[model samples]
Target: MTWTIRPPRAEDHDMLAEIYLSVRRQTFVWVDPGKFHHEDFAAHTNGETILVCEHADGRLAGFLSLWPEDDFIHMLYIRPEFQGLGAGTALLQALPEWPQHKYRLKCLVNNRRAKAFYLSHGFVVTGNGASPEGDYEELSFCPV
Candidate 1:
């Protein structure tokens, strides 16, 4: 399916919130949906740059939430259904234009599938980080 990946607009908060909620409902989703109340979604959107993937009909098929690091992909996600359709790669391809070096992100050890996806994308395990919940191993990726 054809798609357009674009920076999220102010009006996209409701849609973005839906994506966030969907991920939280996923079996591997470690994030708590309660923390992303609609009232604060816009604020979170500001802290984490949002990119929405729009299908040919203009529906938001997925999104990538990037946390900049020295200007790189700190974190990201695509709707589970659209995971293998190049949406993640499209988001990664758009990051370097701002002039960044290495990108780093953490994944819950239980999310084996996601970890594999990162590995396939050229990210390597570098170290580990921990939240109150548990350990989140960090994976680093350099633009190829």
Candidate 2:
């Protein structure tokens, strides 16, 4: 099976938006349900690398958004049907190739699946951090 990773085009909005919305709702249950949308994706995706994995059959399997400064993985999501595939692993292995200084990100306290994913990828807990817009706490991860 082949997957394509390329710069996004305007037509990719719907697929990207769907993935963002899924992760946003699942990860940010405390936030507004509508936090993920086309405009939000368009705006945040600017000046960042958002990679989408298109399956051999042309399905939008998953995506990852990387912010080089804080090494923020603003989001990562795979369609429910596509979970457990190499899509997530492929997306993550593609990160170090990106230009970045400090590699850091936060995972929800209750999202063990996500935390485990980061852990397996060599991310370890450094300390605690909060969701800037809310009271939720996150177990911070750093690659060092």
Candidate 3:
């Protein structure tokens, strides 16, 4: 399915938060499973450059939040139904500065699927760190 990737607007706030929370509930089942707060997701996305993915039918498919100045990807959440459909790649490619920026992200050690996706998209495992739930692998990708 084709998807349009674009910068987020104020009206997309609630939808973005919902997507964030939903994807979290689906992907991070090991982290406080079955619990998600939109308020917390909203706060976490504040001040980040967020881009939303819209399906051809106009439904919001996914979103990615990035801190451009820091070259970090804070979140990249695609609806469970939309996974493996290229929305994640589209969102990552939509990063403002392209290959010029050295982008980094963290994937929980238990999220093997996410780690594989990141690696397949050119991200490399750089390090690891402990978190309240467990250990997370730090990954970085230089777009070029």
Give the alpha-carbon lDDT of every model. 0.69, 0.70, 0.86
Q: lDDT by residue for model 2 over 1-144, one digit each (tens)? A: 567765567788887887777766776676787655656767867788788878889888888887777677777777777777778777776676532324566676666687788777667776665564453234345434
Question: Using Cα atoms with residue i matched to residue i, what is each candidate's TM-score against the true structure?
Answer: 0.78, 0.76, 0.92
Off by over 4 Å in 2: 30-38, 96-102, 132-144
Clashing pairs in 2: none
Q: Would you give me the overall lDDT of model 1?
A: 0.69
Q: Pick the candidate with the highest TM-score.
A: 3
Error of 1 at 57 (Å): 2.0
What's the lDDT for residue 42 in model 2? 73
Quote the positional error of residue 101 for candidate 3 in Å. 2.9
Sort order, lDDT high to low: 3, 2, 1
Best candidate per lDDT, number?
3
On residues 41-70, what C-alpha lDDT tens digit does candidate 3 reach at each position?
Answer: 778887988889999998888999888788
